[model samples]
Target: MRIDFSNWKPLTIREVNNIFSRISIYWGVAGGCALDMHLGRKTREHSDTDIVIFREDQQMVYQLLKNEWTLYKAKDGKLSLWLEGEYLDAVSDIWISRDNQSPWAFQIMLMDCEQGNWIYRREKTIKVSKEELFSTEENNVPYLKPAIQLLYKGGSSQIREKDFSDFQSVLPSLSLKEKEWLKEALKRQFPLGHSWMKSLED
Candidate 1:
């Protein structure tokens, strides 16, 4: 089957985890890439890992990873780092929970808590600890879930036709249970766009 995710597997699974393990980078594999992992899709050729990191972790991330990951600034102070062919993008808002940002226009990745914690020592896939991983409470906006990482790259800050298009593609993969929770999540996370969900669903 032809895998149609936006970002392909640019690096080996081990390599992706290794780069992120340093400085406890909080990221997730979102977009078609994440869907592929969930569906057990075969590894295909890719150039980027399609990742998201917290704004607060920037300095710590640079100090530990600059030698390997070169920083490149995108429009609006948005940044990214390239390492061994994979790219990691810095999101505007990451650490705060109540203050919701945007939904990932890409794949969603969890810290692989099932595999292992994000600790470099374990040497296994970095596990996103449950306590650390955030999830949508009852509303629909994106939040971290165990074994999954949510990237907030949405809203007026990143308002682009591409963002909605990406969300539409991933909609089918979400379950009814998720759909039910998401609406509420959206309300709680994005009060401003309480109508945004309706527009997306339409």
Candidate 2:
């Protein structure tokens, strides 16, 4: 089925927080919005908001939203209804809406973790303590750390112009430690090299 990309009406960070407050599992804002959260300001327009939850916590999240929300699994360029209690082992992206006809609310991104460490799904060897995986800012808004978010953007097979823009916009704000972490992660994930390493090095 063809999806109407325009139908996305992402909720604000505050809204997301309010909705997720009912659940006890770990969840945090991700993607461009996450970078903006780290910067304490919006950098550009974002078509959708993404929230990440560890893959193992899917059932709890599913149970929380199953009653009031319409969830569709997005895989191989198609969408299908996500049956109740269905474990999405290989699926990573889930689109949520109020109902079949309602504008899409937000996207859920599933991440993998083991033994209290957040494992990079694309590269199992790259890991960080779950405690360091996310940050709760002054506003109490939890979000994926900028360094980790940039790692995801940089590792994309087809990096977009916005990804570059995001990197440039957030680079100046990254701490020495954050830059070092991202640089090392890029080196491991892309042994050949990465365009962002030079900037990180300097």
Candidate 3:
């Protein structure tokens, strides 16, 4: 679901914590904000904040925010109001806002998991344990690992300009293990002619 972007302002880190910290769910910052978190500083202006939450804990999020915010299911460029206690596996994104009059605060990208293993939605065969899915900063903020985030960014057939910039920003700090993992993942997903594969190799 989209909102009034005319006066849009992305939530700050403090705002993110205040809204979600108390909620009992396995979630972490994702997308551009997540890259900033891993770097321990904001590197650029964000159009919106992306947060990841497992499908299983979606109700927890719904329970916590239903009273104060309106929930809308966003999928395939369409928007629909999320019914209370209605869990649709097909819905991957949930947009939140105080009301129609309010600008959207944040978006929850629902993910699939099985027995503590993170199921790569794009490719179910690819899996990673929750431990590997995220890492915490000194301040206790959880964010998707930079390598994994970059994998997601580059996994697509066409890489966005922003993804290229983010990859460059985080490349210097990648551990040997991270680089290897991303390289292998790219191999599996792209198989051939993937633009990022060359960069990952060198």
RMSD, one per candidate, in order? 13.0, 1.1, 1.7
Question: Which segments of model 1 are wrong by more than 4 Å?
Answer: 1-9, 42-47, 77-173, 186-202
| lDDT of each candidate versus the true structure | 0.40, 0.91, 0.82
TM-score of each prediction: 0.44, 0.97, 0.93
Q: After superposition, how far is residue 134 of candidate 3 from its true place, in Å?
A: 1.1
Worst 10 residues of 1 by lDDT: 94-103
lDDT of 1 by residue, 170-198 (tens): 55656665554555455545667653487
Supply the global lDDT for candidate 3. Answer: 0.82
lDDT of 3 by residue, 1-202 (tens): 4545443456776688777898877889999889988988777778888889899998888888888888889878776789997987999987777786677788889989998999887767888998779888887888888988898898866788998899988887888889889888887886765776667778
Model 3, 136: alpha-carbon shift in Å? 1.4
lDDT of 2 by residue, 107-184 (tens): 999999899999998888999998888898787989999999999999999899999999999999999999999998
Candidate 2 Cα deviation (angstroms), residue 167: 0.5
Total backbone clashes of candidate 3, pairs 3 or more residues apart or in separate chains: 0
Residue 130 displacement (Å), model 2: 1.0
Superposed by TM-score, candidate 2 places the C-alpha of residue 31 at a distance from the truth, in angstroms, of 0.6
- Give the clashing pairs for model 2: none
